[model samples]
Structures are given as C-alpha cells and as structure tokens.
Target: MSRNASASTRIRVAAGAAVLITVACTASATALDRSAETRSPGTPREAAALTGSAKLYRPLGDDITFTFDAHLAAEHRMDPAKATGTFRFSHYLDGRGAWAEGRIDCLLTGGKVAVASGVITRTDLPGAQGNRVGFTVHDVGRHDRLGYSWASVGNPVETKDLPKCVSAAPFEKVKNGTGDFRVLPWDPDFLKEG
Candidate 1:
C-alpha cells in the first residue's frame, strides 16, 4: 500500500480501538451500579438506623402522670458498641416524682416503628434497678405513640426475662406538643466506607 494509505488505515484502527474501550468501560460501570442497587434492605449493614428522641406523657388516674424520655443513637455499624444513648422514665404524682435512668443498648427500626432495649443504671421503681427494659416507638405523624414491654406483659413483677429489642405495639398516644421520635434510614451513598 502507498505510505499515505497505510497511515490512514492505522489511524482508523486506533480510533476504533478507542471507541471500543470507552464502550466497555461504560458498560462495566453500569453493571456495577446495578449490582449495588440490588442489595436487600434487610441486610444488617443496610438496615435503617434509629436516632433522635421522644418524650411523652400519659395521664394516670388520681392526678398522676407517667413520663418517658428516650434518646437514641444507632448510626454507626463500624463499631456495634457505639450504637446507644440514654433514657429516662418517671412518674409524677402530687409534685413528687420517681424516676429511672439507663443506657440504651439494642435498637431495631423499620418504617414507622422502632424497638429498643436498655439496662437501667439507676431507678427508684421497685424491682427495676439493673434490669433490662424494652420499648417500642411508632412515629405516626401527628399521632405518635409508645409501648413498654412490661406493660404489654401485664405489668408482671419480673421483667428481666424479656428479650432484647422486643416490645409491644405502640399504644400510648403522645399528647400534642409533648415530643417526637425519628427513625432514619441508611443512605448507602452517605454511609459508604472508604
């Protein structure tokens, strides 16, 4: 072939190779993204985490009120031990209050519901010291409510037998302007580890 003709053929070959490489890279990237998207939401690493707090009040007969305050954090999976916060529960009657405080341990959340358990660090509630407590929170917009495992089990004398992260369905309707609870889902993009 003539020199110019040979040079032209080489140029076309190089251009075709460049196009093929580009197309292959694009396809590989697309496939990778699809695989990531197909992961199940129920996977522990992909499961929704619980955060935020809720404080609610329930009126008891004879001028008494029960108050519960829960502060939760389950944002990090890097260290499972970092997934907890504090909780305070109390009952007030005639200006006198009895209370319990503890550290939240296990948290599981899905959709509008979240279940959490903690070890009570201090409390004046009879037979409640150093015991595990479980509760459920339902964030139903303006009608948020909560349920305690002990209450759900008929207020039994002993509650240390309840399982972790287990609670009854939310039943106590939170009074308006009392408090709010939040259940945050994992955002894979933001949570991706390097």
Candidate 2:
C-alpha cells in the first residue's frame, strides 16, 4: 500500500510541474505579442529603420551642390502615410550656402531606393520657409545617386505648391568619394546587384 501511495504522489508532483511550465510559457508568449502590437500598431512586426547622408555635387557646375542628412523610422501601421524622423538639407550655389532643418514627414522605400519629404521649420534658404521639400537616394555600392525636388520638379514659384515627397528619379551620380547614401533594407537579399 505504501509503494502505491508513493508512486501516486510522485505522479501528482510531475503533473503539477508540467502544468506550471505550460502556464509560464503561455504567459510569456502573450506578453511578447502585446509588446509587438504596441510597437508597430496593427502590424505583426516593425519595419526596419532608415538612415543616410550625402553631399552630392550637381553636374551642371562644380560649385552647385546639395547635401542631405536623414534618420527616418519605420512607418507605423496606424499612420501608413507618414514616417517620423529628422532631415536637414543644404544647397550650395556659387560658393553661397543655404540650409533648412525639418522633420521627415513622408518616406517611401523599395530595394535600394528611398524617397523622403520634409517641411522646413527653420531655414536660411529664401523661398523655402514653411514649404515641403523632397529628396531621393539610390544606394549603389560604388556609384550612388541623389536627387533634389527643387531641381527635379523644377523650382516652383511657390515652394508650398510642390507635392509632398515628390521627386524625379535619382539621375545625378555622386561626384566623388566624398558623397554616398545607404538604403538599408530589412532583408539583405532585397538589395539589387551593382
């Protein structure tokens, strides 16, 4: 009788341990799911972030240049139309420099290409105050490209009239080793061959 009781007690303890482990695992998984939902709202997971900078010289003249610095976060599913971050732009012409700093309002990316837009909050650039500007970056290994909406869309009489995040395809090559930009993809295989 004692042997049978001992066996029964051992069985109960083993069963109790198994139940406890299962409960712990389920609770952990539930917590993880809730965390992901909060981070990306309506998505199962967050998209990868983007960051890049460039100092591209225009082909029209050696003195003409456009510089860009950006840090853009993944678009939240709740606000699918926008990406949040900072973008600073600088234009140089005939040795004079004008710059604007703003928050990145829009971003679109595919493979190695990324286009972004921002509204100028502060600037020394005339005619750019309270206006949205666009930019494009193509991340090719040795021969990257960059484009400015002011040049691609043509300098509009009213900068505010320019469409948000609109820019022509990146056509100007980086002039030298001093210029480059990167479009980091979530998957390494998504980038195109150079």
Each candidate's number of clashing pairs is 0, 0
- The predictions' CA RMSDs to the true structure, in order, are 13.4, 10.7
* Global lDDT of model 1: 0.64
| lDDT of the structure predicted as candidate 2 | 0.66
> TM-score for model 2?
0.61
Clashing pairs in 1: none
Runs of candidate 2 exceeding 4 Å displacement = 1-48, 59-80, 152-157, 186-194
Using lDDT, give the best candidate's number. Answer: 2
Candidate 1 regions off by >4 Å?
Answer: 1-82, 153-157, 186-194
lDDT per residue for candidate 1 within 106-134, as digits (tens), equals 66665677777778888877777877877
